[model samples]
Target chain A: AQTVTQSQPEMSVQEAETVTLSCTYDTSENNYYLFWYKQPPSRQMILVIRQEAYKQQNATENRFSVNFQKAAKSFSLKISDSQLGDTAMYFCAFVTSNTDKLIFGTGTRLQVFP
Target chain B: SAVISQKPSRDICQRGTSLTIQCQVDSQVTMMFWYRQQPGQSLTLIATANQGSEATYESGFVIDKFPISRPNLTFSTLTVSNMSPEDSSIYLCSVEVRGAAGNTIYFGEGSWLTVV
Candidate 1:
């Protein structure tokens, strides 16, 4: 069984600053995928970024990027030039090699202060 | 990226009653999934909604409790039968979009169910 862990329960970032949310997962599969998702008050889950284990390069999407360390089983999300809209519940997930099912972390509630 | 929608964005159901949550995707998809998110908890996958076939449930989930229907490639439904307060949670519908690896999953605006 694969499990994702998000150590931080809540986080706050000042507008225009950057913040990083930490994530770690335990899996036996050599090839897998990692993902970060954002859920606003609307309860709509939106994909932030994705990283493949085989890729040595990190994944970047606009202000959202991931620091993926496959050796450490660590995948973290970094939000740069943070805005108020970035305030939401962020979840880290792990997808196994065999199944499409995603194992999600407890989540971290982010607040961007202006 | 698939644009997915879930019907009855929210509902208040009485205990012992049942509610069916509908998921509709803008385009056809090969896989649809159902998930449950309890308050302050992570998303837990309920089952895989296989088009034209019966759903594949995860551990701790059963067909009798969460009956799912995937009549076609573009739509699916999940019903929570014999609802109770324990079943009160945000139900989410998701689809897998083909990506570089295989398929990336996306979720809909969850349907919040409040049972009392």
Candidate 2:
């Protein structure tokens, strides 16, 4: 069984600054996928970014990027140029190549203060 | 990316009652999933709805408790049977799309159920 862990329960970032949310997982599969999802107060889950384990380079999408360390099973999400709209609960998820089911971690509630 | 829609965005029901949430996708998908998110918690997979077959439930979930219906590739429904206060949570519908790297899952705006 694969499990994702998000250590931070809540985080706050000033507008125009950057913040990083830490995540770690335990999995035996060599090839898998890591994802960061954002859920606003509206309860709409949005995909932030995705990283493939086979890729050495991390994944970046606009202001959202991931620091993926496969050897340590660590995948952290970084949000740059943060805005008020970034206030949401962020979740780290893992999915193996063989199974499409996503194993999610407890989310981190992020507040972007203006 | 697929556009997914869920009906009865939020509902408050009495205990012992049932609520059925409908999910519709704009495009056909190979896999549809149901999830539950309790207050201040993450998403937990309830079951995988397979077209033309019975839904596969995860551990701690039962078909009788969460009856799912998948009539086609683009539609599914999840009914919470004999609801209780513990069943007050947000139910989400998701779809998986095959991509170059792997399958990318998209979620619909969750249906919030409040059992009073």
For residues B42-111, what per-residue lDDT tens digits would candidate 1 score against the true structure? 8989999998889999999999999999999999999999999999999999988886566688999989
| Per-residue lDDT value at A32 in model 2 | 87
Which candidate leads the pack in DockQ?
2
Candidate 2 wrong stretches, greater than 4 Å: none
Work out the TM-score per prediction.
0.96, 0.98
Share of native interface contacts recovered by each model: 0.76, 0.76
Tens digits of per-residue lDDT for model 2, A18-72? 9999999999999888999999999999999988899999999999999999999
Residue-by-residue lDDT tens digits, candidate 2, B1-116: 89999988999999999999999999999999999999888899999999999999999999999999999999999999999999999999999988777778899998999999
lDDT value for candidate 2?
Answer: 0.95
Q: How many clashing pairs in candidate 2?
A: 0
Candidate 1 chain B: 10-residue stretch with minimal lDDT: B96-105
